[model samples]
Target: MTLQEIFALSPIMLAFGVHAQLSKTTQNSTSNVKEEDVEVIRIVESRIQRLSSGATGLGLDSYETPQSVSIVEDDTIANYQLDDINSLFEHVTGINIDRTETDRTYFNSRGFDITSMHVDGSGVPFGDIFVGDMDTAIYERVEFIRGSNGLITGLGNPSGTVNYVRKRPENDFAARVDLTYGRWAKMRAVADVSTPLTESGTWAARAVVVHQDKESWLNLYGNNRNVVYGVVDGQISDTVTVTVGYSFHDNNAEGNTWGAVPQIYSDGTQADFPASTTTAMNWTYWDTLNRNAFAEVSWFINDDLNFTSKLNHINYEEQSELFYTYWNTGLDRQTGLGLLGYPGKFSAKDDTLIWDNTLQGNFNTWGREHTFIVGVSLADAQTSDLDSAAMSGFDVMPAFAGWTGNEVSRPEWAAPTEAGFADIKLNRYYTAMQLSVSDRLDLVLGGSFIDYDNEGEAWGASTSTTEDGTSPYLGFTWEAIDNVNFYASYSDIYQPQYYLNEDIEPLGSAYGRSYEAGVKSRFENNFLISLALFRTEQENLYEFLGYDDGDGVDDEDYSDDFTYALYQGITVASNGFEVEVSGPLNDEWSLIGGLTVLNMRGENGSEARTHIPRRTFKLLADYAPQWNEKLNAGVSVRWQSEVYSETTGFGRITQDSYGLVGGYASYTFNQQLSLHVNVDNILDETYLGSVRSEQTFAGSPTDYSVTLRWDF
Candidate 1:
């Protein structure tokens, strides 16, 4: 019912529905849409619409792009009410999300999970363990450019790239505020505001702030976070535009409680860790702080030329560790005894500087079409930290409710803080340029060259320096059917060098290549759909393990000394197909969905390195019914196929896969205010988002959150 209709009835009746159940109700009915598939018109933001006066292939020569690409539009964000990195990412095809205690965010795309993030064509830094540590408030649209960016961003994985575009100042002032409450005591508040700084509308400023806290399915694990972001844009003249932005975020966690402990008992029978065992080991909680700033400018040289440049800086500091990792101290797998696992105090800091510049040109020949783009990129980052630890030879384990920041006294260990920390520093740079040609006939040709270098030093037994090279990209796109676009692209990627291990041996550099094909289409601005097939090969892979340096010292010394180094550049490859559909099917209803299937394997089970995964899948869907202009309700579901990775010592480990479902209904009584509630993980699906065999740590559990939002 419309808000007005419900209001006219009885306030008591509306109150009763407000307290109704928030559960997912499946729809088994088949789609009534015509059998003949129709292309979905894209309702994407202006930045990604690819405007062109002629039949010239959209602004950028995507047909000639060396790698794969995906775009998440503004409509997607507004419809899903995405106010964070995870929600924005969930809508992108091939992307996966795993929330660890609500403190950290982990994701996997293609086949690699520990991805390097980038924003506005610049590389963004990640936490020590390779988790994204950036605020999403400063972003308006997200562009995913797959493949090697040797010609664009310089250094990145061949799997793909994620580029976040900060929200730009419009010609007028605008703002949005949202409040939400969901199951599990979840409460969230967010505000985004922008306005012109001058009557001429040449200067503009915008800001976004968010604060949220919630519990998890796990016993003692949960999350709390606060983020602030601001940006300013100035038009120097009719031909010039400049932009500056910054963001600060703090992620405070209750526990790092890695995944569940292995299923084992005193007699070897699979037994659960007591449904109440939430805290993994003794980790109480940890906190991390991150900040970033950047400046960008664009110049319109002439009728057919434009130049753009951006410089970015990022910093991160970790105060405490969520949990102390415990591994099998003995190589013998039979004991199953966890060694040295508990909560450890730690501190770390990281700083990064990245820059990117691009030039775009438009020209005409023989009444045909030609668009060109040339760009270069570079980045440097370093991180290090120290920590203290204490272990009880054999102590009684504690339950989730009983776990706290209090430390345990050990008779054998005094001033356990004596366990120092590892100090590390690293630096790297990448440069690339590309030129493309396109014909109105739906054909494009392009070529690019890339150069990269890496050098770094680390204390605590390791220091090294290295460099590498890469050159490979071929692509093609053809309109097979009336509105169907078929595309194929190949690219080669490379990375800078880093330390090998505790010995400081240099692993030199790493490189790889990718092959992909897909077909995509846009509907009448309501939604979009696409399908892709891909495969990738990586060389010069890095390997880590416990090595006996032939010294009388025990494995403890070796484990501490052994780090990682390049062996022979193991040949690792992955192939898969992905399908994505998003947009409203009708006036009253809208939907979004995707699916992925991966097949990746190593050659001859090479010990040097192992293939990422044999097969995996990711799916997402959302349906919202307008139910009259003043009232709306909808549900969203995201799912990922199981994951499997092999270990040099352990044969194969399987990561269970699962799905997460959420629903929301909102009512706006007036133009200035509204109330809404959402239910996440409606089914409470159980699954692991990540796993570290060596550390014996898994991701957090499935839970729900209830939120209340408001705007003026």
Candidate 2:
């Protein structure tokens, strides 16, 4: 049914702001409502509600939107003891993680790469190999939306988008602390405190601090980190609200690997490395530092009308010193010889600023209630990098068979020389309207106009590129039953290309279109189920061709170094289906599960995209017995199909399918204290975690941890 009619069925839960508070006492003090019953309702609502800012400009339920959305809230994160954003994505639905390196990772959806990210609804830029080193303690929840989000994020792939919602100051005083210990000497501590600054509880502040230190499965590789965050929230007046926050993170680590272990051996057979094996040297190091400051302001004109704006500034830097090896030179299958090494030091920095403004409200047209939203956003990002040689006496290690992790010494690097710099700016304006067509149907129409510009230095020369276009979106939703809704949507996206061809001509821009249809249903107001089918077509996709240089170097032009002239485009089509079920099925049990299947091909009907799986499944469940209120247990399973990639010397390497099983148990000592134990990879399965163009990374073995949480 229409949005207005659906809310009318449950005003106590769907109403907003001052209007909803008036009847809070009446609902809580009802004659039939008991304390335990109220607690169950609160738990269910906190875990299953569809209130989010990512699905639409205004908070909309899953049945009201035409896209796929999944959220990982604070309760789930704490229960699972997820340390960071990277760990959370591993359990999300319809998404695949490609951990090419220990610290760097990439996400793929529907055979396409996801490059769009937002913090508190403001856009953030992304790079190829940069790690988004964020601590999860400062976030309220992480939201993932599938399919094209061009209506809000401007130019990007038609894959998906991610948004991080920060924790806000509460009106009451609260404090919490957690201590955790795990294998590999891993130890972590976190503290969170929120308190009101005014007697009326209109002004408040919150602070979160975390410290973590851990040793890795790989030899000589470990991590040490420190994070601090603080936020202030104020109800300046009855109509105004404001929030400001700042966060800082620093990470130090040793034995950072530049690439994966060698996959090809001397006898032409694929080499298998032990889980604890590593090519990283004891003296190698990589460190990162990130700082962010943000502010948000909102004005509530009425229950149905509101205006919001946000500003964010981010600064990030990374420094590294290392020595790496490659088999680009043909390997000697008989002697395990013929490898080349390079020793270098590098540093990079990125600075960004983002601004966003939005206005949303409800209005009546032709005696029907409708919702409308208008927004404008701008982002500017600048990056610079430099590289230099290592210490004078430290030359590239020449002997691969006689080297060990203990033979390396710390490097004293020389001053770096300026390599390049870039400046990118993006501007976008968009509007959307949700119209109630009939008692059983709703229509959504929106479009975004984008202007993009880039200026940088390439190959020792100054360069600039500019492009602009409009992305259009349309969707329709029909109520098929009391709680089941069917929806269909179509969206288009455009992005500019900055590469030059062999003839020194700039290539054409990239374009893509997505079509999706889905059905969603909610049972008992506590459980949710959805199934979706989607098809996407992309053109002008770029790839670099290996242009053999006379020196036997595969893709390099040794003379002028590898240039963009070798990159060209090809057409691709991808189709996929996804299914998900999540939330509580009853008062004593909860569950979450998902499955995905994909088919992607090129112009010649050949399988496209290497190092990515074609199918994936995940499940997590928890149960608390009614006979015992102090004990709870959980279990999880994850599986992925086979994947393969071609090598220059070995021809082709395939990784067989594998599955991992884990479980958790918790004992509640009282209302304010609890202890939990968790285990992962219980079977200790040995499998390839990720495959790169020339190498493969191995997965971790069995591990366990214990956590104690105190809330006051």
Best candidate, lDDT: 2
Q: Model 2, 115-152: lDDT tens per residue?
A: 77777667653433447346788888888888887776
lDDT of 1 by residue, 313-369 (tens): 678787754443334432223443443434445567776655555666566675654
TM-score of each: 0.77, 0.89
Clashes of each: 30, 1
Give the distance in Å from residue 339's predicted Cα in candidate 2 to where it truly belongs: 2.2
lDDT of each: 0.51, 0.72
